[model samples]
Target: MQPDPSSLLQQALRELDYGQQPANLYDPIRYIMSLGGKRLRPLLTLLGGQLFTDELGPLVKPALATEVFHNFTLLHDDLMDQAPLRRGQPTVHEKWNANVAILSGDVMLVRAYELLFENVSLPLLPQVLRRFSQTAAEVCEGQQWDMNFETETTVTIPQYLDMIRLKTAVLLGFALELGATLAGASATDAEHLRQFGTDIGLAFQLRDDLLDVYGDAATFGKRVGGDIISDKKTFLLLTALAQATAAQQATLAQYLGQPILDAEAKVQAVRAIYDELHIRPQTEALINEYFQAALQHLERVAAPAARKQPLHHLALQLMDREN
Candidate 1:
């Protein structure tokens, strides 16, 4: 019998820890992975693999490779963003030396591939490896673009969308496609699954941007308005830029570009302008647009409805989540 999904996740977590050398490195990996956020990407991949076959034995380890890889990115990202905490704990770089953090991250990538190719059929393993490499490179390109946007004074909506497509969405799409391929889905079906993941991932990122500025602080898991405080070029900020009036433009310029401002006051100020321009509703509408597109692709996949229902519900939950 196929292992239960929850059981598979647990088993994968266990397998990830096998064969660690340095206790220091191994302990931190355990610590970060144990911090516990929604393990959505790996779960999606496992679900994707199971859509074609009941056998999860071959899929669980590779599916978890995605999660490990993702956390690796988070470790490095926290360093780059100068983020003090992750999931409410000190970031790896903060708790350990930067060189150690970098070295550990490299090990995580190596382990991701080890898990992926360990039991994979040799004939098909190269193909999986090549595809994974391409996806990994694309994710890096996306991150670079995201960083580039910080120095950029002006960015269009389309450019922002494309940037996010690479940075945030491609990995999600690749996760599904990876699972589908492992399960022997037809290439076309795998592509459809990938498209579904990409669409939903885009929507998910947009929703996060929305929640960062507007969500309730209590339920948001982190402080609301972080993006606004950092002056990050979120979709909402772009939309506000597109719609602001002369006075609104001056206000935005004065506050968004200024330093040494109060967090709560800045949040309240920006929100007042967002309200004036109705940017919140407009952003919500755009988020709905991507969700609809994702649903359309999901409905076209050649999988059984029963098998896809859980993933569909998961997509909905992610799109609607506050945190």
Candidate 2:
């Protein structure tokens, strides 16, 4: 019997050797990888493959490639955002330095490609590379758009949705598609799985936006309202802005315009706006929309229901939709 996805990935990560030379360059890579997360992307890859075939051994390296690339993005993202922490620990740039973070993140990208090229069958290599490259470029585009939104005052909900889809959802789609492709699933089936992943990814991110304001700081693994304090445009904030009365708009603007205010006061003020506007339910409704769409796509995949159960359960669990 194949090992569970979590255990399988843990063993693979433990055995990965980044080569010890100039500890500074390689150390950050190891450090970030060791900072545990849900390991969701790679696990999706494994589950994607399981939908088509039982021999999951060959999918391990490619699945790891998704995880490696993901962390590489986070490493650089932290640097760009000037974030102090990741997974509740000092970020790479914080622990080391910006230069180290940049270089190490670059190397991580190279290593992700290496992992992909190492095990992918030659016949499948071109297709895999093309998909991976497109996804990588889109992720960058999304990040750039996110940064642009910080300065641009005209951002819209549709634009925001597209941004998150590219920035966060596409990688998830590609991960699942990669696994299905590697496992010899038909292109049609693979695309269905990809759509399922993309939809789930959208809901996952929207849930994150909701959690930032309402979640327990300890469970959320970061300070609640960090987004509010920064005036980072999230779905909640945007929705509230759209729905607020002129008086409410003035109130929101009053709090948000302050160059400096007590962090708690800012959070409370913004959260009060969100609460009055029913932004929580609005966000939750949108999340459910995407989640239900994901399930529809998952149902369309040609695989047996039993084979698809793990992925379905994972999707439910990730979105807190599980009964």
Candidate 3:
């Protein structure tokens, strides 16, 4: 049976020992890992392995690599975004300097690869490393695309979707596929798991976009309209631009361009236009479409029906049961 995800996360955390040679360099690694999130990606890795094999021991190190790599990206991402807070605490760059954060993040990347190699066989190691390398590069490409969208107001729905796919979905895909590969799952089944993770990631990101505009402030952990205030080209804004009329488009441009307005006013104005264009419903429909597509991939995983149920349940929960 699969270990409880929460316990698995705790156990993985306990096993991490980044060493003490350079306290400054390694402390940040420990600090960031300590400030944990849902640990979903690592859990996916463990789950994927368990679905194919009874023993989960070999999967732990490789699975933890995904989370380590994930945190490494976040360290750099926080620096790039100049994000003041993460998990309601000061970010790596905030607590330490940018140079320290960069160096620490770099080491984390190296460590992530080291961890993945722990239990993987010499022959199969190349396959896992190659795939991990590709996914890591794609994440950087996605970050670039996201930055591009900031100035280029003409970004289309497809373009935004692709950006999210690279930035968020691909890692999630790798998380699931890596476990299956480690467990010696067939190539076809592994591919299905990867596709399943990717599709679920797409829908999960859209849900995040929706929540940014509609989620309660207390629950969201930040201001609900921070994206609108900053003119971040989220799905809601992009969709509104796509479906709005010439007149509606002009009004939107006016609101988006007005940077000096109070935050509430800007959010309210943009959200008013969103409601007018029925952006919420349009986004919800698209999320459901992607969620359903994810299920199709999950169904193709070739695992026993019972083994697949846990992942299936998670996919549904992620998309808000729209599927």
Residue-level lDDT of model 1, residues 1-323, one tens digit each, is 65677677886686566346787677677777888777778788888888898987788888887888888888777777777899889988888867778877878788788878895778779988888888888888888889999999998999999989988898899889988888998888888889889988888888888888888888877778989998999998998989999999898888887893588888888889999989888888988888898888778888889988878888878876643
| Clashing pairs counted in every model | 0, 0, 0
In candidate 3, residue 51 scores what lDDT?
A: 79
Question: Per-candidate TM vs. native?
Answer: 0.95, 0.96, 0.96
Per-residue lDDT value at 139 in model 1: 80
Q: For all the candidates, what are their Cα RMSDs to the real structure?
A: 1.6, 1.6, 1.8
Residue 211 in model 3: lDDT:
86
lDDT (Cα, 0-100) at 29 in candidate 1: 76
Evaluation by TM-score, superior candidate among 1 and 3:
3
| Model 2, CA-based lDDT | 0.91
Off by over 4 Å in 2: 321-323
Worst 10 residues of 3 by lDDT: 314-323
lDDT of 3 by residue, 1-323 (tens): 54575586688778789877789899999999999787889888878887798777778888889999999999999999999899989999999989999999999999999998876889899999999999999999999999888889589889999999999999999999999999899999899899889988999999888988988776676678878888889999988888889988887778786755678877888898999999999999998898888889888888899988778877766766232
Arrange candidates by lDDT, descending: 2, 3, 1
Candidate no. 1 TM-score: 0.95
Which residue pairs clash within candidate 2? none
